[model samples]
Target chain A: MARPVHSFVCEIGRVCSKAELKASEQPSALWVGVKAQKLPDLCLACLQAGGVFDSAFTYPSSISSHWAAVYVFCVPKLSKPVVLFSHAKQFHSVSAQIPAAVWDERKMREISGADFIGLNDLRPIIIHPESAKFVTNPLRGAHAPGRRPSARERSAGHEEPAGHGSEYGFAGTGEEGEFQIPVGPVHAGIIEPGHFRFHVGGEPIHKLEVRLSFLHRGIEDFACGRPMDGVLPLIEQVSADESVANGVAYAQAVESLASIEVPRKAESLRLILLELERIYSHLADLGGMAMDVGYYASSSRFATLRENMMRLNGRVGGSRFLRGLVVVGGMARDMPEDSLRQIRTSLRLFSDSLAKTEDLTLSSSTFIDRAFSTGRVSPEVARRLSLVGPVARASGVPCDARKHFAYGAYRSNAVRESLGQGGDVFSRFMVKLGEVKESVRLIEHQLAQDIDGPVLSERRDLSKLPSGRMALGWTEAPRGSCMFLVRSANKGALGRLAIRTASWRNWIGIQEAVRGNITADFPLINKSFNLSYAGADL
Target chain B: MHEFDALLSPKTDRIYADSPDPAIRELALFLKSRPLSPFSRSIAVRMVDCGSSNDVELEEGLTNAPQVDCERFGIHFVASPRHADVLIASGPVSVNMKLALEKTYRAMSRPKAVVAAGDGACTGGLLAGAHGVYKSGRVEEVIPVDVKVAGNPPAPYELVLGMLKAGQILSKKRI
Candidate 1:
């Protein structure tokens, strides 16, 4: 099975002159380097040959000029990813052929100073336009730390910037009475900050533009010089709820780069922790959706269940958010056997309570009325945008990373992907609910295995390992698929750490889902998607 | 029918822990004892997310959850800064959000108290000295902080305790 995929990648390498297949430790991955000029065409050819566009990022080049770019594609029937690498400072934009590459190329153009010809929408996404003077490109190696604003600039900023819509060229139908409504960077509710602009005529929306990165903390730049083992806490902060998934993803990238095999017991414990994270994370989404529709009883019940899950997490892993459990090689320490037993026992009660909550929510006419056809994302748009996790699954696109790129315990225990037919708010709700139940099943299966071995691998320190090795780690987070691209630098420090979360991929889907939705239903629609601003901004 | 039947059986999952932190209760009593304290009974709080990882916001929302339920102790999260008497700001104030955070602070009326919630808002946490944020990433650097709740992201009980402390300070300011 792996033989054909290697030749297929080799065939791709043959299409462009002076192509070389880079040696890799993982047999599942095929890394090929081609001429920089041939990148756009080669990317199109890969897309044409049934490969799904996964992620693209640029890093500072060691051997050549300023920048080197890597484009990742996930081919069907192959467990690992196939990556195309090129070292260049300039290239034709592949966004012309693959729409998913647009944001990636624009980001590369801004941060790494790479020139992508024919790229549209070159406005700064991460750095605010007003502060562009002080911080030009933080990702550039020689770029200085941004200076504090002067007193004059501080006084100038006292006045609120007028019409946030004008900065993003607020798109709308120019017909009479079609006015613009701008909301946030600071929202009404207790949620992460991101700006939303709605172009509306009366109640119905003409268009919606979501401008994010208000939470961009330069996480990639922060990770630049840090040792591989020390960055788990930083990765865990990517999104609090998805901490374990992100940590595991970063860990897998480092472990695979160093070619370390995690022990059996560690793998089992990791699976339990990962599934518990998914259950708790999805519970919030389920509860929030109910709360938005004014189903307070059901919402409170779901919150109660989520609180129980978090307490269970604290009891088992010692952190409510389940941080500090997953490290570079394997588990940080062994989970108490009694606590594992306690989880297995309490899950039955949890399952029963959830069933009742689901019954109360689904049976409510008010919930059905608000959610049934509201905030619809067609399967076509989901495919075009490369939406992942539950949002893509709700749209009937089977794109679960757990199923496609199985890692650790997921390799032995096949996950049953819960899919929905309608891409509306109700479908997303149903899909998430289904996933919570499946997570319980997955956890039960892991505990039943009774595997025992050393939780942490002996070869923990990667500082002694050679550098310049790069690998991709992916996990099926509750929101969707999260991919972390890690490159080992000199003395095991991180050369580059590029993250693409499920929230980042699915935030674009919200813009598509809210096309014709009424202004009133926007919150309900938005809550259903529950995209994370921190994940997207980073 | 299942919903109706379940109602008759009445399975209550209500958490019976320390409903209000003992510190919060003691503070509430102390505030009630003072005649000059305007916010002894209730205080409206508006949360400003200055670029947190969303953990602080999650913990803030959970303050309203049944297990923690800070509302019974006179904490209300308002929709507008104008309605709020207390401002709870979180995150390592990012450069992009510096203007917005400052504007939000300005929007609140005088006699308003600000509580910097979470490690990020208090000391910039993990992102301190990172390029994307303003100096040290503390909310105090951008605005006056009357109270500081410190944790990776403070738990709900800790957040409520911090807000109560802010209320206690707000009363002194009023006098």
Candidate 2:
């Protein structure tokens, strides 16, 4: 079924004159290659033509003369996504049209040494300012031709020379009574590090700036030159909580590039695991929201439910976090009938307890008072930022990939998208609660289907697999849309891998959401949109 | 109400008993014999994630779950390193965070002990030698680690056991 948006993209290509449209093997996505000079105009036309910016990334092409700047857009009524590419010798920028493109463009500039011409915020992203002198982009010399500049030459161009006191110059509101509060990079809780700067006048926050990438582990660089199978573990490590989603997205991308058809049973099992992940992840957020509100009773109850789910995951999948379960072609292991039975029984128990906890949490006046209207993000801000997953759903934007893209088992069984209109902490909390219930129903429905078949597809030798094929794989992770673009090179090694996690997209929304809220309410607001630093940084 | 009651009285004893596999049992016994055991049993731990997938952090959070309540064993998570007796570090030591890790470790008192949680912190796990990762990605390279809990993300029981073992090290050092 060709989506109407595909026709619109084709129309844009014809009008632009310098663009060539190519059909992607992956359903619901068309690739348009445009000339570098026409890219800005074409992208502006795309936005005018009703395309919402999804993500933008740059990767060195195997041809070596130029790097490819890929911009993904979600066109309304298009079943397939549209990706516009423009080749550049050195630099190009698109943040002038779409503000969300700034972060991705900055990252591309730093990692690939491409000059983004019109990017206003050019501060160093992935590489820390202090370490910029010592650490060069790992991918700098890998594919680029000619003698690469020495580390000194590369470091000289980047902003903020080493040891110039503060790593980032805090841009303040400059009000007379404005004071700054810096939190994290090393927080008091058991969480990953990312620094947050809040400019506050009394208790009200005037502006908030976030500095991340402390967990940049060179994952994309590490994937290069490694055998395809060897990289699944690394992809799964992108974010511990979203391992199943990331693994599935990476696997699907690889599978699509290789034209591998996974057995029906494997798809069903994947759906089950993905839903289980959603349940546990959302439960953690629910519990955290309660804890932040000082509702210990409901928080502990939610924690108990989450722990039960984790234990069930251990019994069913052999890992509490469901690691090493998903592979490129299919699942690494199959679920036995007895394990399925146990999961069903445990899920029923969990559902009943979760209902009680949800009731208790929503009924509490104090919990409601704290979470009701705090950290409100209007529908406009959410749409402008292109927020995804529960955060967007909470703001009443229907952006669920499962419903829109319908990959894997979702194609057979439709997913019910849970939405809330409040656009506040309470709305996000309700949306998560609603999503948890939906996931429980999805798991139950999936388990009832006939799921007897080979779990793992026949393994193809990595060296023999075709090379230089690019494919996009995406999944609706609990937080939002987790997408992966994989380019395979000779010998089954990855040429380029670009990831857009839900946290990466929704983090900017938090900066806008916390405005005007009191400093004391910051933790509550932050928890409502609980994003991952490692996932975003990577 | 009965279900709530049952949840409150979890099967923690059974889980705890099954947890002290030969390696942890030895550590438990060693902890009991330390001269400063009384003061050491109740220890405050500060966690610093150098560069983990946050899986280790999830496991660490579960230690506070009612099922694996480490507080009953006199172990608690403190906000500041200065007040902490044990430092629990998870994930591979990323190059950017190496200095912060060192500063955090130095901020702790002299009798402090470090427990490297997760395979990442213990031996750099899957991320070892990655370009952005520090040397070996292990906590021991930057600071002395008394106990290493090994798992992609060590289970909550394992984390509890590792922290206890670190508490024992603190006790031994104090003597």
Candidate 3:
């Protein structure tokens, strides 16, 4: 374990002053402290070491008054992720070089009021610029750092997002017949609220600007000062469809923070729950892709399969969305013998039905024609944005967190990182189809194992964990890989909780995918990626 | 050939049982027996997600799924509020989305009803008074709600039941 950390440190030594690099180790990751001036150089060095830019966020320092930024990178050959920390009040921006870091930096700017010196796009990512009336940047710890708000104090002096205006200056083409079309904050579908501005001349789109954050509810800020046990509900709300995945990720972070090992039975049950979520979530995307193309028959069949899947989930976990089952240390409660038996039978039926539906859908020539080349997110752009999950896989990027950053049951299961080369809607469809089969096979495999034991591990007093101890939890959610950065504060509370959902990374893919596609195919392309507005906003 | 075979096989029942859920069955039977009104027979709904984490929206979509199929009960979700008879808003209404919620409510013509679906909308759920949200985060705080269907997100059948009640209220308002 120390070998990889030493190698990473050795790599960092070549680029910057070794004296300024202070390295420390944790059970799961290596933490290094760097001067703010050295952030860009360290980030570049990490990237050169074959590290993928995982996530970056700003948190208030515990001992000092200064705000610090942590940039995390997942490097190959390292047993754990590498985290570099620096005080970020007026730090140099890495977004100028690493385009993937743009949104993270923009969010850091708004939340912590951190000034990134050389950053170009300084637009408000969460709080709308026109409605920036706040006593403080509501999320910043400067006002009442580490102090929990009482019931009555929750609303007073809090910033209310006010304006509903399309005021962001979208770069437009000055070509003849070019016109801009803005859609939503409230859209035409039953989907979540987001705005998409298109620069279209007639048939093809010149540029597409996606403005989200309409559903930003300050989930991360609200998690601060709350007890570790109390924060799971909020994490579950980050994206409802990915509840089990987010819960498991957060639980793993907390479990790792306290060094609690989960029992095997609990781990197997969690695997079942996570894969069930993937199957249902991917089903929605498949159905929506077909529905958008006017193929109602295939779409309805997919929806039926999804409904049956959800009903099975309801039977197993008592909630259609599979909530309240994955608690911090282990399973919230043991799955009954009957439920497991039911699950096995249901999965068999599900796979058989799924095979029929996949066969039926793929056999349709009209469906193929519509989905074939409609929304193409090239492999180059996918890499540039650091996209994850099926969207990345469809574009030939193969960045599944389950396979790359293996956690829980995935570590032993040896996931096949399903790949597609087309980088188009059909490729994404095929990728999701492949993943659904994989998830079913995985669940079946897990169920066949000896998984009978205590569901929950013995509860520990989490407040005993050292202050400022932080851990990273990553999960391959249905949409993609979502991450949780948990930093322990005094008295078991989280000082700062940063969430980066797959939708956050993949939302940019939609903007690129929509380019050159006709206005009518926009919905099809958007459905192909199926990025969650609330997940991205949160 | 595979498509035809799959289509021919009865995946879902041709007709649902009369009362799988007693509550939903009661509501469906009541709606069936109720006199014909503009909304009693059919209600056009526009769902606005104020800030509930997309769960309520998924349930709303599932209401259209073959198992729950709210379409059989004449519950049609529309694209525009102007064409809607009931405005279903899910919340803890975010501060950013409050104005849009208000605008959507105002767009619907009179003789309209509002259904606050999900615990978030009805009582602000977990994120009640958190930052980036208005006071209490309830739909009624911003707009009047005739029916409040509460759950973390009420299941599809529950939402359909709530809409059925909303249709009845819309009928009364029309009179």
Best by lDDT: 3
Error of 1 at A291 (Å): 1.2
Q: Candidate 3 clashing pairs?
A: B92-B120
For candidate 3, the TM-score is 0.94
**Across residues A68-114, which tens digit of lDDT does each residue of candidate 1 receive?**
78888887666677788788757688887778777877677666545
Candidate 3 — which residues are off by over 4 angstroms?
A63-65, A133-166, B1-23
lDDT by residue (A1-538, candidate 2, tens digit) is 2546556766676556532544453553667777776777777778777777889877876566567889888765665567888777655577877887888887776665666777777677776866544343454465531113347756866443222335577788898999999998888888889899999999999999998988988787778778876798999889989999999999988888787788889999999999999999998999999999999988888888788889889879998889899997898888899999987887787777777787888889999999988999999988888899999999999999999878999999998899999999999999999999999899999988767989888864567777877888899998999878888889888887889999999989999999999989988998899898889977
lDDT string for model 3 (A307-348, tens) is 878888887889998998888889879988899888888887
Rank list by DockQ: 2, 3, 1
iRMSD (1 decimal) for each model: 4.1, 2.4, 3.6
- Candidate 2 segments whose C-alpha is farther than 4 A from its true place: A1-6, A18-28, A133-166, A459-462, B1-5, B8-38
Better of 1 and 2 by TM-score: 2
Cα lDDT of all candidates, in order? 0.81, 0.82, 0.84
Judged by whole-model lDDT over C-alpha atoms, candidate 1 comes out at: 0.81
* Model 1 alpha-carbon drift over 4 Å, by segment: A10-28, A133-140, A143-166, A173-177, B1-36
